[model samples]
Target: MRVLFSVSSWPTHYSSMVPLGWALQAAGHELRVLCMPSQTAAVAGAGLPPVPVLGGVEVAVHNRLSYVREARAGQWPYPWTPLHPVTGAAMSTLDEFDLGDYLRTDGARFAAASAAGHDTAVEFAREWRPDLVVHDPVSTEGLLAALVAGVPAVLALWGPVGTHEPAPVRILPDDLGDSFPRHGFGPFGPDLIRHVLDPCPAAVAAPVRGQRLPVRYVPYNGPGVPPGRLPRTPGRPRVCVTWSTALSTMTGPHSYALPAIVAALTSLGVETVLTATREDAEALGPVPATVRLLERCPLYALLPDCDAVIHHGGAGSAMTAMVTGTPQLAITFASEQSRLAERIASSGAGRHLPGHIATVETIQAAVAALLQDVAYQRDAAALRRAALDRPSPVDLLPALEKLAAE
Candidate 1:
């Protein structure tokens, strides 16, 4: 079977798809991934064939202000943002981009490019006739195109879906939850937040509503592993701190309170490794002698070797730590981060830190507790055992093969 996977241009989005793409390919399915042109090399690097979509639109001007700030911060525009610099600029430059007056008004060329990408994807699928189409949470255009082509589509949500469980989901909505009102408004209207929550405005979930789609959760920007191997760690109480690399681009290294965290962890006699993009490492200022700065080490590699994990509470990081039987101290930045933190806390594997209010003192105490507290470690082990009981992607592949045959 030929499987077509679609995602926004962010590396975080593509990272999650890599394992699945590899699995499908291993299962003898031809896997092709569609992403923004700029991400071509990245997708290729992940060992998957790249299928360009979105008409190679360059939507940089719409986010000129953000781009300037990012440039000043030593970062460039990536498609992690909603009205992403790339997509917005594409909207401005294209004649066919249409998401209503708001999206199209940005520019004619941008509009054309957006529409062209979606239309082209649909036409491509009609001609190519892939057996299955998998879309990322934000790929509204791709989802629509798949629907138009009458192929079975599954949305793989890399982040929060916003709506609570039990809510009827017809199509994936693009709601960014309740944080929009907090940020200033201009081109990003309130609807932009709502739109992010459900990207597929027209998807009807009649046959699919209660039937859950396969949401294979993996880390956003995971440690690029060494082939078939995890990272090597020594015999000591290890502490790991990780955060979204994308956030490093928007805000500076999330350094409001992590320094205090390091101080506290050092006090606890724990060895720490803070992981982020190399750019963030410099922006993060100084690392304690005890704290290691890692560029790319598989998280699962380090988790099993750790006593505790700390971070901004991304779903992938939390789960990796949990599956590895490591307790967590989650310092969340966004609404979804907070939600995952809450889930971790409720699950008894970790605890959450208040947004923006996370202090070094609080983080220090949490890490201390996580390292010394037997209950936290016990809970982590319990959850890890539970996770191991459930079918991993590797275990489920055979079943999917049979389902595809049916």
Candidate 2:
């Protein structure tokens, strides 16, 4: 079988699909990744062939314009406020909006920006004639390509929210009407999503959707070598601190509280390992010698030895820490992130702090709790076991093959 995977330009999103891609390849099936030019290197680094479709600059411009338009329309909110308190059972406004907007627009802003690429992907799918296409929710182009090619399309969710909720009626964009007529798929809808490969464990998973398929969460933080000269084992309790590479771009410079977080961790006398990009590191300026700063280091490599992790609540970071059995202190600024952080806290595996309220004192207190509390460690280990008990990517191969054959 030939399998094609499509993803957004974001590295984190693409990384989530790598293990599945690897599983397919290992089964002697052919695989290719359809991505923007900017993501080609990341795809190739993972040893997958990249089929570059859209112009990177064009996509980037559209993305920026969307942000600008949303900001101008006052749709952009800072430090997402939850409808219910962190540990509450009530549904959040964010979830309601995301599901409603996603079904209505199918991510209209991004879809519109990548409309041309959607055509290109359809063309590629026709030429390549893959049996199956697997894609993340945001990469609607993959679904379109598969629909046009009469192949099965699988939705690979990066987190808990997407497939769990009841999908609303899909409102296809007028602009995309012409593209679908040739294939006779008049309008896209939730029914078109034949399968949903979810990586979240049942313990933290959202309410069910019929097509949901549980896949074990695998940690892939991109290709990187472990830093040399670091201690084999820390003499003290070691804590890892990190922020998403995309957060600063989306939320502005004010979102970067690495300096304060680092200071707080160091004050607790715990060994601090700060992972960041070169630009983020420079922005951080000088830090105390006690804090170890690593540039673009893979969290999967460093997280195993750490007792606890403090992060911006990215799905990759949260899953990496969870799979490693490391306690977490997630300081989230967005709704989706807050949901994940809340799950961590409620599960007894960690704690959540909203970015707005994540002062130095709160951060220090959370880290101290993660280190000193035995319950956190015990719960983290339990979560790790639950995650491992789920079917792995390779284990899903038979089902995917069956779907493709059908």
Candidate 3:
């Protein structure tokens, strides 16, 4: 079947969707991916074919106009009207951009690009007559077009659905319940659904409400090429520290807790790999040269050798640590993050660093406890076994394929 796969952007969003996309392609399905133009190269780097959408033009214009408006009025997103601009700072790193803000800030330009994405997809579907359309939730612009053109659409949600579900598309959870933190999935509660997904239930009733597909939470973050062996650093067990671009932006990985963590880990004789941006690392002050700092390594590559992981509860990062059978140290940055941290601690996979009191000492203590206690690792490994025992991509792909074919 010919399929038009749409998403918010590539590279950043690709890892979450590529495993499924590759499954469809390998099974002889013709698929074309659509995302923002800025992400073309990253998507291509993942070894997937790309179809660039012209949405970035509006994103660019909106950003500029927002600056102009912010300077003139000093109002944020101008909430009272639809002309609100969702500035970069106002958005969370994960699922940050909003169409309403884009529309309000860029006006006609945003409309034109959104229309173009719809038109392009519709035209492609009308010509190729794809059997189904699998869209990323953030690409509602494309989903709108698919609905107008009377095509079947399924939304692939990578993170928490954030309390809202767009219409005429299926909401498939990548991770849910207690497993959310263990697997780095969103902690989307029924309340979030009431707030975010319920507003337009009618638009999605037929496609989503009653029909929920089994979740597919597999992550393709395997160690990249060479998979070269690195010399093991023998020390008091090791713990891995990582941050998603969102956490890095939202709370600054260096927040006030850095010195405490670094000091604690050192005192425990545990080594650390602070995986984040160079700027974040610099902001963190003096680091023991022995502590490694990696800017762009994949999470999978880092998890295998670690005894435990320390992170700000992003679904992808959390899952990578869980799937590897390593203990986790979740530091909550926001409400969603705090929920995941609690879930992890409750699951016995790791401990939570209260966002309200995440001092250097609190962070240090959590890392020390995980590294020194073998029980956390034992429990973490058991949870990993449970996750592995559950349905995986190998099991989920066929089911999704059958759905598409039907």
Candidate 4:
């Protein structure tokens, strides 16, 4: 089977797809990944064939993320107040923090992005006629491409879907753009996805309301040689503080609280590794002696070696820590990340500091809790064991093939 996978330009979303893409390639299937032009080298780095589609909306993505960060910081809202009645208790899926105008703004943003990417995708898929199109949940363009190409498409999840149990899916829009015409096709729904591949462990999984396949979270930190840096185990409890590279790469690094976090953790006598890009590292100015600044490392390879992980509650980072059996400290800035953090904290395996309110003191205290609490370690181990039980990507091939056949 020829599998064509698509994603938004963000490396974080692309990172989740790598494991499954590699699995498909290993299974004697031909695979090509179509991403925004900016991610071409990254796609190649992951050892996959790259199809750089036209009309890359990277600037739009950057602007949206920047807006979300600013909104979370109370700098300004996304055209409206964020505290809506729907925002009660549930975290935004770490999607772009849309403030209050979530549906219309987000819908329009999706439509615009889809319109930008869909035509090229449709043209290519029409010619390629791939057996399957597995797309990042955000990229409905891929789904339309699949529709026009007469192939099945699956929605690959980075986190749990937003809907609660007994998911009531609505009809998909009649058209995303000129390319995706819904007149001849059957009814579509909000996401327009036929299958969902969920990677979160049951302990933290949101209730799945639709057709979902359980796939193990395989950590892929892009195509990089593992950097060798030993965490000072047996000497002092080694704690890692990190932010999602996507957040930093799209917006700026979390400049406000990072240095303070380093100082407080180092002062607390714990060895800390601040894993960041070289640019972000330089952005931090200087760090304490007790803190090690690793500019680049394969996070999946580095995470298991740590006693605890502290980061911006990205599903990738959080699950990496969880599957490694390391306790976590989640300093969440967005709604989805905040929810993921809350789940980990409630599970006794980690602590959370809302990024909006996260100060140096809160970060220091959360790290202390993650490291000192035996229950955290114990619960982390239990969670890891549970995560291990999910079927691996290779193991899901039979089911996926069946879907493709249908």
- Clashes (backbone N, CA, C under 3 Å), per candidate, total 32, 0, 9, 4
- Runs of candidate 3 exceeding 4 Å displacement: 10-14, 54-112, 145-151, 159-210, 221-227, 233-235, 246-260, 354-356, 372-375
Q: Name the better of 1 and 4 by lDDT.
A: 4
What does the lDDT come to for candidate 1?
0.57
Quantify all predictions' global Cα lDDT against the true fold.
Answer: 0.57, 0.75, 0.56, 0.70
- The weakest ten consecutive residues by lDDT in model 4 span 165-174
Where model 2 places Cα greater than 4 Å from the true spot, the runs are: 55-113, 164-191, 207-210, 228-235
| Candidate 1 ranges beyond 4 A from true positions | 55-112, 159-210, 213-236, 251-257, 398-406
lDDT of 2 by residue, 175-257 (tens): 23344554577665555677788777766776444477788888888877787546844468988887787575554455688
Taking every candidate in turn, the Cα RMSD to the unseen true structure, in Å, is 9.6, 7.0, 9.8, 6.4
Question: Can you write out model 1's per-residue Cα lDDT over 177-233, one digit (the tens) per residue?
Answer: 211122222222212211111111111111222224333344434437523423444
User: How close to the true structure is residue 285 of candidate 3, measured as C-alpha lDDT?
Assistant: 79
Ranking, lDDT, top scorer first: 2, 4, 1, 3
What is the Cα root-mean-square deviation between model 3 and the actual structure?
9.8
Model 2, position 239: C-alpha lDDT score: 89
Say which candidate scores most in TM-score.
2
Looking at model 2, which ten-residue stretch has the lowest summed lDDT?
Answer: 166-175
